[model samples]
Target: MATEYLSEKHLRGFDKYKYNAKDTSPLSIYVMHPFWNSVVKIFPDWFAPNLMTFLGFLILVLSFILLSLADWSYYASSRTYPQHPPVSNLVFLIIGVGLFVAHTLDGIDGKQARRTNSSSPLGELFDHGSDSVISCLLPIGVYSIFGRDEKDYGANILLLYLIVCVISATFYISHWEKYLTGVMFLPWAYDFSQLALVVIYIITSIFGYEIWKGTYAFGFEFRYLFVLTTMGGSVVLSLPNTIWNIYVSYRDGTGKNRSFFHAVEPAIPAVLLFVVASLWAFLSPTDILQLEPRIFCLTVGIIMSNICCHLIISQMTETRAKCFNWLLVPLMIVATLSVSTNLGSLELYLLYCLAAVALILHFHYACSVVVQLADHFNIYVFSLEKRSPKAARVSNGTK
Candidate 1:
């Protein structure tokens, strides 16, 4: 039926806005419309299949709900029941699984959209946008279980990093849109990063050491060389894949702001500070027990992750017009400076406010950017459908 409807003769005669037809291409190929045709064909008369964009949003929403419920500190139970450390590991494992599951669902909506020829800007926006929330929220949810408070200035920093992710993603997408002919959006790799982090957490929960440090012959204390190495390596490993995605997105024709220099942007000073601080920790034996490696890892991860977030948000064409985003670095600076100022209560209050403000702004910007991106994609898809004879006919029939 779709073939007949999209046939050249019919397309030549058809009014673009007045008719709708199906594009009977293998429904499997489109990421956004997974199972739509099969579902529709199985019960064409009884049920309407939602577009992949809708499904992706739905899954994202559900994932957030699940994360909200999964306490990161469920591992505390292990502390109480020493004999059953496995319980804590199990709890953490479950949370990790939930995260992975959410990540998995992340791709389905895109797949579904493609299969049904129902791809839209909203779908693209929603699919990518939810990531900002998930990225920050996942860490927060996990950290909260680790005894961190939302009020912990660090948590707020994580949220700030989340904003960066949104910025970076936007930057990546928009910049690429400028140069690339089509979206080279490797939705899989992006999703895989989240999955790998979950695996990292699982490793942490199962073994206190970050690496599989075996006992040295006749040594009283277990050597932790492997753990430190892995943790360091994981951080490094994460950086390239992330940068690759950003590079691909920036160079791709789909994004609009294409500058070679900008593509190789510098690490934010804050990130450099983190690297310095981390290197300092590793180099100075005095800082080891005082600044726990795990805590250091988490902090550095939070900072670096946010850097990615910033790059993601930068991908968006419509974001950061407001002056407030510019304040993020200064605010982070202020918070860091407070530790040195010795202003006691004043420092604490100011840091608190900075974190609170950053979190609110980050989420606000992310949500807004994602929505706008979605709208733009929707318009683009609709325009393409209206302009393309085959697409026009298919769209009309669908309506």
Candidate 2:
């Protein structure tokens, strides 16, 4: 039966396959769009799509830095979990608003490009690349808001890490689907999840961080239950959906069995990073959270960023997904250090610095790929004007 379906779809030609964008969120359609469309209209003719992408990323980075500083201070004071966050309520408010605005700008960049007649694959790469970084940062910020203690070895800590992994996996799979079927699937959960983060910030701002630390009707910690449910839902809902999508694509011949490596290759770095971190956490004498809570977050953020970078590069170059092998160096170093001896504060600091360097290098690769693709396509990264209209025409035809 599978062979018959594949044969029929092959005869039909994969070029006939259309990319589908699915979004069922009423909040996004009824509430967000009305407002977002209005804001897009106000964007001046000269406002470049890539600029909006970069600006949104800048705002998210600022929020992450503030949150990290606050978290480090709280950890340094030897504060226990379930306490109020050390940051001011005003900061939470600002972070919430900033994230929302970032989301807004990200959503409209394509429209801005279309309006300015400057749409290119580079615009898509920039938008997704920024999103990849923001995805890691946003969850880390939320974890800090919950005042999660990384020092403790418990189910809750494991769940927290699992939640981060699940988020990254969903993102990875989404891009994998794009690689396979050439369609970007926007699940309803994606938008709602972002809104939920925004709501968390608002709640922290109004009722104070103590609210998140409190128990709910079921006598479970609210944050614990939230993370548990997120992990559970991904396993229950998302995992199955992803499998079904792959199956359908194969049946439709939009995806080829010979290209399975293309779908799985981008995930190799992420998997390796996760395994190395897990080994380090288990083997080290000192708890990773105890070493430096912020460092753990940074490690996770960098791994996710590496994964995102690989996805963007693969898309831009139209090649099989490749891992950022340089990232493995720090992970291997940390893993080796874990069982060798107890790492002092100085050693931890050095590790943090190394991770930061890895992050910078990963982003450099992403940026370089975008520049090369832009130059090849003859489109300006920050302008509506094409560098070579004839080249652009030729590229469009090839695409």
Candidate 3:
């Protein structure tokens, strides 16, 4: 088989086979319309064997993140909105299921790419870009839908979500590029962090005052210390990805003069604030606890700080390359800020518009590549297959 040189520019036009080369080649597996094939090609069977395995690792990482985040949020919401209908817990369940579904679909696209042999640079560009956007937006959207009316509270939740996502993605990307090169990166240690948080949440939900009674196991309250531990641990554990990213960036001559150690934000203060909030809550009676505006207010502040941290980190790394990962932050902020105050309607028009634009652009670049490849090969090989001297020369050499 003759090997062809594929350039970065040709990614949008790589789907065609030889004009009259018969159906003997593997490329024929993708003979359908370039546009449709590219769209369908993002499944498991399309991925090369190696890529499929890597995709599995990513799916697991994503699953762990989903499970931990869901558990923590559910525990918090249970106490934070104790008066809301039991139906609210359904939202957390739905998010958990959604994560699983999204991860499964994510696994398929790579396989499709491999099975059809339609893998191209632009397809990759779209896939990674989509994941980045979804990672930052979905959580924020959920928070807005459920907690938007809580004034700065909802806004804060969305902000922190944005921050963690930005830092995590940036670091993961930088780390993967540095360590794995051709393989997808996995943050295995991150699972431990999530596990730790789940434990903290369980303790907080059950005990309430053990953390701030200042006697270790003496007063043994579950209070706000629980929220602090979970949130603080989340931020602290998130350091691995960020630190790895910074290390990679600096080693790659990209970090310039940025201080590595200085980048570690003071998680202590935030953790302490959470402790104070928890103590206040613990001292209050069960009934009053439900009405405390501070419960929602402080939660929002923590979330907002998280978001701000991510934005700042993203902006700092703007000129360092691969800056598109930050695109969701501003868009998410805009959407959250623009929603109706009552949350009566879903108002998904903006979401729909964004999804459509991304899809159109993703497929447009892919289809153009495949179609162009078909055109080029059709003229080059099929037109003069028997007549061209070079064809005979190449054919003879093969034998």
Candidate 4:
């Protein structure tokens, strides 16, 4: 079948594709997986795993939408903003339930695929590709609980930006490691973080967001603890482990075994993302993030997801990863314009435009890649059914 976004090399590599990974997280292994095993049983075999993945994605979208309705400027729960009303407890409760259900569905899609013998590289693409986007949404949703009021316990834009960057980077690192080592080492923080966020949402729902409006005994805010723990876990545990595993792969002569330059090549797009995002937020003439954080965050998420989806295609098909992504070109342009010109009130409009462009590009990439894969595999994306082969036309254009 003809393809776009995937080259002939990628198409060829899919014939030999196999998923190899290890999930050694105690929470994932002992708790969530078993829980998911039970959960997947509740789904009839006719239900497709990709449907579960998409449903989970939609649930998160709903959560984001609900929060956006209440806290469009992210001042909903701000102690500093006396005029801004608090987010509805009902909304938080709904978000909590949505997050839990989405997390559960995310956990079970693979097992469901196996149960129905519907597993394919497309599953990985859909699942993890969706996850790259989910990685950003989860943080932005959680940000709604505390918000961007730096005067109080809420995190400032830069700190929240840092938290978001850390989350997306850690996720990309997992796949980048796989790109280099040819095995996926699932992160331990995922299950634990989701559960913890659920707890946070529940606590916020019950006790009100005022509960976190205080400093810890050590004089630091409780909000900083999230950043600390997140960075601490990655630095002390995951980062070191990833480095060691890649080192072992190279030393033991078992990995892709490319030179140092090539080994780190896949990270270029992400680095550019971090640099441009930081400059845009930090140097915006209009303080774009404060004006509209959700748009900025979602734009980053969408672009990051696009980069990640490309990496996923490369990893799944065992083809070469891109050194740069075209999605970043417009991003760089927006960042440059935001910084170089005194756009004033117009800068916010520019950000909205950037977000629109990002969404369009990401959506096009997603649809094109999924359709290409489905056509090449002679299978449906959100269904277990196979497609009838396309009728061939000869010189006369006759089937």
Best by lDDT: 4
Per-residue alpha-carbon lDDT of candidate 1 for residues 1-399, written as tens digits (9 for 90 to 100):
211212232222221212111222232246334533344343222121133334444554554445444432323222333332323455556666665545445545444455456554344444555454444444334433332222211122233233333433333333233222223323233433454567766785677322322345555222133223323333443445445655565566434454555433433433453445434333443333132322333333334334444443333322221112243464446545544445545544454455455555555554554333323223332222333333322332332
TM for every model, in the order presented, reads: 0.48, 0.82, 0.36, 0.94
Considering lDDT, where higher is better, how would the candidates rank from best to worst?
4, 2, 1, 3
In angstroms, the error of model 2 at 384 is 2.5
lDDT of 4 by residue, 318-353 (tens): 777888999899889878988998988888888888
User: Candidate 1: lDDT over CA atoms?
Assistant: 0.39
Q: Between prediction 1 and prediction 4, which has the larger lDDT?
A: 4
Q: On residues 1-399, what C-alpha lDDT tens digit does candidate 3 reach at each position? A: 333223322322223211111122122233323433454444444234234433533554454354445433422333255544222334334444544444444545544654655544333433444444343333332332223223212223433433344434443343333222222333333333333433433443354312223323555333323334434544554445545654676677654334433333223333343443334333433312233232233232333233333222222222122213222343344244333232222323333344444345434533443333333333221121223434332221221
Stretches of candidate 1 exceeding 4 Å from the true structure: 1-94, 136-260, 266-310, 313-325, 329-333, 373-399
TM for candidate 2 is 0.82
Of candidates 2 and 1, the better by TM-score: 2
Flag clash pairs in model 4.
none
Error of 2 at 250 (Å): 0.5
Report the C-alpha lDDT of model 2 over 1-399, residue by residue, as the tens digit: 011111222222322433245554577788877777889999999989999999999999999898877765343212464453467888899898988888889888977887887776667767887777776677667775655444431234455566677777777777776666555656556667777778888988888666765567778766667776666655665566667777888888875453666567777887887888777766767666545655675677666776776665454445556655677887787668765877766557656776777777767767665655564456777777646665452322231
Name the better of 2 and 4 by lDDT.
4
Regarding lDDT, does 2 or 3 come out ahead? 2
The global Cα lDDT (0 to 1) of model 3 is: 0.36
lDDT of 1 at 50: 31
